[model samples]
Target: MESLQEKNRGYGSIFRNLNFFSIWIGQTISVVGDFLYIIALMWWVLEKTGSTAAMATVAICSSLPAIILGPFAGTYVDRVDKRRLLILMDLGRGVLIAVPGVLYFLNQLQVWHIFVIAAFLSSMSTFFNPALASFLPVIVNKEQLVRANSISQMSSNLSGIIGPALGGALVALFGAGTVMILDALSFFVSVIAIFLVRVKVEQVFPSEERKRFLQELMDGLNFIRKESGILGLVVLFSVLNFFVAPVGVLIPLMVKKILKMGAEGFGVLGSSISVGMVLGSLFLGMIGGVRRKGTFIMIGIVVAGSFLALFGVSESFWTSIFLLGGCGFGFSFANILVPVVFQSKIPHEKQGRVFGTLGTISGGLRPISLALVGVMGGLLHIQMIVFLSGVLVALGGLTGFLIPGIKKL
Candidate 1:
């Protein structure tokens, strides 16, 4: 058992646990590479094809694997040696990512090549995510979950700050092929960090605990159906995501058409949101998060929507940046709290499936919503669409609170 002081240590205490820190640093580096590579890929594709279809293919290929494979990935995660799986996945992905960089260097890279790599990486991600999520609680003390997650979010957010700016600079100075090598190397770093962290026997499922894979998957869905709070939370996020997806497609248009901002100005707005995410993540990590988890989450939904709406209405370039920053801050709350609440509620054995299912439901709407919004933009004022979308999200996020038990958590 941990002492009061130990439990209260928050983010600072996470470093003292070398196991968590190693994975944290490794994963953060990996995230930086991911963003950097994405910018390089997008820019290269645009330069080559000059087609929106090629760009949209990137989004579709990236998401298709997750929507299709997440549940099975979660099921297997519950059955496997999670540490081994993480290491293997990292190794596999490192090799795969490097293939493209190598091909590009040889001047053999084609636009179709990007789509192939995206599909493979997306498939592997389904396994990597559930394995990592389920594995966290095994290594860190329960008291440290929130801080640990917050730190994780902080690192990823930090990469969002660094990745694009740095990627653009490096790609310009060096080239896409060279910058991609950096992404490949980050995985090696991740694998090394995972290797260093000792996986306790208790962390692995007992052989006797194994069940038929089909049953295991069903059990995961059953868990969600049985828990009203979890069900409500899932529904809240799904509805929120459905409404929020349109904003992603609309934001760039808003900046260009409504605010009369140039590409550089739009980029600045992105950086502001990333900055806010980093700050919000750090604040949560340092404070160890709020005790009234449910209430905080509810407030986050409203705040996110409120700020998003403000961004829609604001005429000043700087004002939009501030509101978007707030939107990012609110997202940090949702990102950190949703997982913590799930970890607290679900049994460890079932976490992979639950989180996987939750992730799919939450994320599945994105591609659909993006398409719907693009079509809707043709008929409605994009600004009106954005404002109404924000309104819906704010309303949907609050719906979880109306459930009887969620507020008490």
Candidate 2:
């Protein structure tokens, strides 16, 4: 009871801190704009190209830049001023996305323009993501970390919920071009929000010191290599990505083909997961955070995977929704805890690079998994594949408990 009351107090404190609140509010607005912009962009592409392949190409293009640039992006993040980097990234992406809107109005838009702009924005995300992740630990104190992160996660989830619904309305009224222009305008709001943040940033590298790019990159790799817990984290995610990532491909097919639930079912299933994420993050915030992070993470992963496995075998739509909700809840619990663990362990100086490297390894697995799932799902039963993958994820998650380095951390 005492602990619970303390956690309640912590939640109140998070909102009271004006600096963090300013950033969070601005970020929430921009994120909502991002959601609407993406829906519009995708709608525009499908209309223009009339090609599923084009859609896949755009998705692949978005992932590729982060995979390729993640490590180096982190190095630069560690070296420079994060506030400026963030502002620049948002500005560049804003300008890039806005151009298509103008070109479309002028009736001079080309197919290649969308493709190129998509790639450019994606590349900027590699820098922006890590910088944002690293920045929070600096601005927010350790005690406030859990509530702050929960607030951040909640805002993001809210955007996802609001984005599509709001985007659809805007598109119906003013079309994709207007949505894109509004999206660009959101970036300016983000820039102004960031400008309002008045916190001191202690530089990671000295002004006089300049190391070779490759050497700086290698230092980050070595840091991960030397830390067994970090390596365990990387390897664990790689395994999840390989086996579990394919579930993304399998879920829609399973819904349409096996369950015969169609698009509404798909939307319902998505909403279930989103609800779980929002609720789970809120729950974590209410409880503050767990100290035995690895153990909590291990439990979270195993439970989430088990629920996913159950979701695969479910016949009824409601049952599948229940199981998926459980899975989402468990994963969200663990996800929040993992970042708290990482922020505590990593130095403020190397946070950007470390986070970048982690992001790369985490996201890099999807393409390979998607490829294999695409092929294998065509040949074999997708539900069975999903079932087996869930089991593998559970098994893989257990390995963390077995590894002393990670478990004890």
RMSD of each: 3.1, 4.1
- lDDT digits (tens) for residues 166-278 of candidate 2: 77567667778888888899888998998888886888653468777777787677778888887887778877867777675456556666777644455457556656667
| Candidate 1 clashes between residue pairs 3 or more apart in a chain or in different chains | none
C-alpha lDDT of all candidate models, in order: 0.79, 0.77
Candidate 2 TM-score, C-alpha based: 0.83
Per-residue C-alpha lDDT of model 1 across residues 1-409, encoded as one tens digit per residue: 9887765585667788889889998999998898778767766675676444466566667777887888888888887788999999999999989988999999999988998999999999889998898888888878778888888888888887788667766766777898788999999999999999986634344257667788888877888989887787777777788788766556656666778864445446666777778888877776675787777788888888888887877778888889888988888888898789988888898888877787787778767765665456667887787788778878876776787666876
- The TM-score obtained by model 1 is 0.87
381 in model 2: Cα distance from truth in Å? 4.8
Error of 1 at 335 (Å): 0.8
Report backbone clashes per prediction.
Answer: 0, 0
